[model samples]
Target: MKSTARIKQVLVLLVGVIAIGSIGYQLIEKWTLFDSLFMTVTAISSVGFEEVHPLSRAGRWFTIALIVTGRGSLVYGIGALTAFWVEGDLVNLWEKRRMERQIAALRDHIVVCGGGETGRHVARELLRTRRPFICIEIDSTKEEAIRKLGEGMLYIIGDATTSDVLHRARVEVAHGLVACMPSDKDNLFALMSAHELNPTMRIVTRAVAHDAGPKLLKAGAGAVVSMATIGALRLASAMVRPNVVDLLDAMLREPGATRVQEVTVGPAVVGQALSELKLQERTGVIVFALREGATQRHVFNPSQERVLQAGDVLMGCADTEQHAALQRIVTEG
Candidate 1:
């Protein structure tokens, strides 16, 4: 049975025993309510206090029964209470240990610093993509909120700027790190620590101040995002190109809507012409750009005659089903 249920049962049993003892004293000893209650408490507690008045044979027998039943119930109730407390502690300890072991076993996972607004959004997107990630937040409340946001999310409670905390998140084996702490200084510190720990890992950070962007990039962040700048750009875009903004919004809100995506060219596609692949006709995917693997240059509105090469990244737009077909053709071919 549940510990709570057991506790309630024990309490009920004790109360019933006390009521029975008091009523027995009143009837068998012919005493007043106060005297009977006092006698019953004394007997149950085993205090050895003298009785209020001399007891008859029946009253003495009644007292003996109350003492045995009351004492036994009290001991059992106390024991249950103690077990409940110890069991709760043990369960918490076991869960903590299990979580630590799971974190230690993760690799190629994303590490997110802070569980603030930006960090929460980042985590949500990662979760949608079914990516493994660990979030570090100093505030207990935010940590709990993030955990509630997603059951699979992993988190640690500590300052992200600290090396020990970063190490605990296994930054060295992580595929990337997102620094979205509220303060620019904290984000910068965390970015630098993550970069130092894993130079090859991609580090993306949020800059609270516009001027901090350059400093964060110099500090080893691969990308530094400014919410203010993005919001400003978005505002301008809404005014200047309402139709374009509407299209983008529709893509975001509608399930299976076509959106721009990228796919890397594999060995099988090398030396093949765009016309031969006929991606648009075959998969309903429109290719917009080709990023050359060798020169790292982009060829926008690539021609049908253009020859596909290994290591080239194709940028295109397609619906859910078309996107899957395009991915299979690009990677498999």
Candidate 2:
């Protein structure tokens, strides 16, 4: 808003100076409109151009006043413009508007609450999955750093545990939301607020307290990941299954490498069989498991004869290009 106000102020001052000079020239010197406009431009610009015609004494005094006033306004306007660009306000304003427009146009997208360490990791994973998401962060200072986590990142600086902020993120149309606020309470509140705004939205929340998981789940979170529990489990796995851990970690961190991901079966392909789809032949995507749409049960190493149902999730390993193909097939049929 400050940047926009500065821009408006500069434009208004410049227009005011031009109007005053142009009108004074025409009335005092009895000059043509074109000549008056030219004199006004040259005088304000300090271009050192001669007057269009000889001037009366009154016109001379008017010209002197115009030059003085125009120079001051021009200097002030230039300073404002310089500050707008040099201080990064111009870029910030542009990015904010672009992010807002992109978020508004999105449907079936993800909303990530917070921009802390955990939130940044979630954002990176979402980017890897090629999902459209807008992050809500309370700290405006962290916005630029969070945006550096991925290209085309959209974000808003506002409290995530509030309904107004969630509404601004278009939560009603969002497919899922991840609450990664600093505290379990903040995450729980955000989960409930988002659920209230869109009851059908699938929410995954982060919990730090040992007892907070149950409360978060009860408060409308579809899933709650306790950071301590996961950390302990990960440490155990790394100790016992070092090779397995390294392989999985390498696959996840390597660019353009095959990684585990899930894609929902769109309604258009509800009755299709795995053999009919031939995902490997068409998109080079491998489907190793099918999560039933009705019961949410997992079937590992699904056979070619397995028929897909609406909302059935396919878990597989795919690279970026193959993942894009799978997403298109699932979402666009």
Candidate 3:
């Protein structure tokens, strides 16, 4: 910010000096506007071009003052510019601008707050799923780690709980946000701020404590997950149902590998029986579980005679290409 301010200040001063010099020449020497401008440019730039017209006694003194002031300003401006370059401020500024443009161009992207382990994992999953997203991390030290999440990663280095930072991340156009701040309060604040900025966007917040889940939910977070609780559950599952755990692990272990996904039944596929779609045969997407549109309860291994309705969610397993085909036919058709 200091570097940016310095550059702005230098530019403003230079412009003001040039303008004043041009007007001075026009008045004192009675030169045309073009001649005055040319004289001013040459004088300020130290080109040492001859005078456009013979100078009066007043004009000579005015020219001397202008030369001294112009040279001083140019020297100061050069020093500031050199500092900006040597400090790498110029490159940083350019990259920040490019990132902002990329972020602004996004639609339906996800915003991930924090650059800790949780946020890192979430970003990796979003990357593997091919979702366009941006991250906001307050700690400057965490910036390098965040950038290493992928090539050309989009992120903001600022407090995510603030509305200004969220706006910078384009919360208004985002489809979802993941709040994974280190503390429950920070995550809660981010969730509320994000909701205020984009009421329709789905928000999932991390719970630092097991009991914070309900509070986050009441605060308008679409869902809340406790890392400790999930870890405990996974441990128990690994011991009691190792095979099932292994299967789930295998599904998520690699990019383009078969994985389970939940997609809402779109209007085009609504009212159609499972058998009529032949989803497995057509797209290799098997619909194994159905969440009824009205009931919101899962019916595992629903019969072929079951009909898909609006707002119903289907959970199925398929590889990347197969899932894309399934989404195009059912969720996007």
Candidate 4:
């Protein structure tokens, strides 16, 4: 349980016990409920108030019992309140404000929704790449688990489906959003909310069900990857193409990891081809393939005859610096 909830529970239990004890005293001692409650409160608080009436033998014994129980409850309640202020309520509020300030200053950062296995993996990759990002998780336990693998990551403990949480995440300024919540419905909802918040924002998500791709896309996801299907394909590839699988594993584990990027054609590269671009010669990068409209073509060793178009996407292997250069060449052209 979170400290806040636990403290609330303790306080409520104490209040209930005190209420019941006061009511019992009123019934047995023939005292008004208010008087009985006031007597119990003073005795428990050790406030040294005068007695309401004379005490018979039975009343005297009852008073003794009430004093012991009431005093203990009073002390316990005060301690719990003190601890709540010091450790739970005030601290959480302070952290929340600090996180908000940090998020407001972020730009070109990724927003991750959910902290499940897939989300965690995505976060780890972002951390490894030293990218700026904020994670949103509904589950406290899962949030704790992700925090354990800390890399100065920021997190907001709330549902990503809410506009308030997205706003706090600085969605309008974020470069992209990754929705990896467990349910396809949740991921789709989060994508929709994020897109509505920032129309031009890039959103990538995972769908639990294979057929949920179209729905997720309609909900504003730029890319919807199905984990189930991908897992199946990975298993099949590992069995039939062990060497290929091993190569991929090695690429991920090695330092200076390689990532495949799609560089779009920019104004400056209007009439340029993969061969003419000379990315390989200039940046030690390779153009693996090219896409124009609905067609994809492998241009491992492209010829100068190929012309670049405004909307064409180039698939290439490169590092961060090369990728940035590719972006500059395509967009700033």
Candidate 5:
């Protein structure tokens, strides 16, 4: 429990004990309640005040015992108060308030539901892309792991499936979310909640089981990745298609030099042919493929007859400078 909560509990118990003792003293000694309460306070505080009246031997002995017990309670209460102030509970309260402020200021960030290996990798990728993001993990150990990544990231220490936790991550304004929790059911629940919170927000989740993919998609996830299946395919590709693996490895390792880019055709390139764009010569980029809606088709060595469509997504290899050029071509020609 928090120090504040512990202190409150201790004070309540002490107050109950004092109340009961004062009422009992009034009944046993035939004194007024006010006088009995006053005596109890004096005994507890060791105030050295005179007694209400003369006492019998039993009452005199009882007074001594009351002094010792009441003093013990008072000492215990003081110790608890000191602990409340010294154990950094105040710091925690302040940090929580600060976290709320940070959440309120966040917009268009990604919410990572787990801080595990996969979630950490996603966070690293998001960081590389310079995207704002927050992490939510129920496990304290995992949260510590995430904190080691950086100080600017906002984190919520709670279950992701809860709406309040999602709210803490600013789901309303978040552009997307990535859920990599261990349980498929929990991920689905979190995805559903996030989607409900922001209907337009993209939700991506990982599934342990192949069957979970459909359920995750049906539950409102924009993308559902099955790690086990993808890992197996990657292993197979590494064995059978070494060149493809090498190309991906090079792109992944070269942060600014070479990257895999997705360029969308806009009004400027709506009616232009691939040759007219002259991207390969102008930007030194290789057009690897074009994804037209759901279906992706390789457009290697595309001819001059290939006209660019408004919504065509070209996946290609380009350097940082070429990426900038490609963005300009797509947006401004």
Candidate 6:
């Protein structure tokens, strides 16, 4: 039974016993309401308090019965209450219900699988960007730690490889999913389940082995990242191009530092020329690449004469304020 239900049952038993004792004392001893209640309480609690009035033979027998039955019920009820409070079950239940409601209301959110190093980083980035997301961690210990780490982040403690867990996280309404399970097989399974649930969801998975990358892609993953390979490449780049690495690190670590971001061209800018838009001059955002909406082709350092398309995506680098301005200019007009 659920803890709440068990608690309710215990409460009901205690109340029933007390009520019976109170009514029995009133009928057998002809005591007033207050005196009967006081007598019943003292009998059940065994508080060594004297009776409110002298009891007759029938009343004494009834008091004995009340003490025998009510004491056990009262003790059990108190123990149950103490256990529930000490174990944090009530707080967990409340949090679980609140998270369920939030998950049900979420749409176009990201679902992150696993709460390991990579998954935590993904969650933290989403949090920093103020994006909606849910993290699924199978390990209860890790889930608790992740909950403490991300104060307001939504998460579920369940095996991500299972379709039921994914559904619970509302993968059907999610815009994307990131599978960062330690095992490549688990990541592949999660990706396949998510793909089956939401065929259009963009899925990115981590591969422990190089061969797993192709399999993950064939299983409907949009991108398969190999952390080991990336780490090796980054190490090599740090050695060969120290200044470039330093600049990249600075962009990620420093506040207000220029970083690359993507903004989509809205309907208002459909037929405008890149030169006319003048994003560089207005928002200090350098448009480095233009991705065609229909063909999914990218034009690096797009020509000024190129006409902007409604669904085209512009990749540029800018500070926080500049990025916001560019987004407003693209989306608002």
Q: TM-score: which candidate is best? A: 1
Per-residue CA lDDT of model 5 for 102-205, tens digit only, reads 88899999999998888888887776656689989988877668867766667888999999999878999999999999899899999999999999999999
Query: In candidate 6, what are the lDDT values of residues 1-333, reduced to their tens digit?
Result: 666787999988988997888889888988888898899889988989987888899988888889989989988888888887866777778888888898889999999999988898888777655678999999888876688656767999899999999999999999999999999989989999999999999999999997888899999999989998999999999999999999888877664546778899988888989888888889877788989998999899999899988789999987667878998888876
Determine which window of 10 residues in candidate 3 has minimal summed lDDT.
Answer: 250-259
Off by over 4 Å in 1: 4-73, 141-143, 232-261, 274-306, 309-311, 315-332
What TM-score does each of the candidates earn?
0.73, 0.69, 0.72, 0.67, 0.65, 0.69
- lDDT per residue for candidate 3 within 179-273, as digits (tens), equals 99899999999999999999999999999887899999999999888889889999999999999999898767765657788778899888889
Better of 3 and 6 by lDDT: 3
**Whole-model Cα lDDT of every candidate shown, in order:** 0.88, 0.88, 0.89, 0.80, 0.83, 0.88
Worst 10 residues of 5 by lDDT: 293-302
**C-alpha lDDT (0 to 100) for residue 287 of candidate 5:** 78
**Candidate 1 TM-score, true structure as reference:** 0.73
lDDT by residue (1-333, candidate 4, tens digit) is 566676777778668767876886777788888888887777667778788776667777777887787677767767777886788678768776877788889998999999878888888878765679999999887867887767456988899988899998899999999999988888877888889999999999988887899998888888889888889999999999999999878766666746777787877887766577777777777776777733654455455567887677877777677888878767765
RMSD of each: 4.6, 11.0, 12.6, 8.8, 10.7, 10.0
Error of 4 at 258 (Å): 2.1
lDDT of 1 by residue, 60-173 (tens): 899889899999998999999998999989986877898899999999999999998888888876765466899999998786688787775689999999999999999999
Off by over 4 Å in 6: 1-87, 255-258, 294-297, 318-325
Q: Which 10-residue window of candidate 6 scores lowest in summed lDDT? A: 251-260
Candidate 2 C-alpha lDDT tens digits along 110-154: 999999988999989888768789899999899779979977888
Instruction: Return the lDDT, model 2, position 67.
Output: 88
Model 2 stretches with alpha carbons more than 4 Å out: 1-87, 266-273, 307-311, 327-333
Which of 1 and 4 is the better model by TM-score? 1
Model 5 regions more than 4 Å off: 1-102, 254-258, 294-301, 319-325
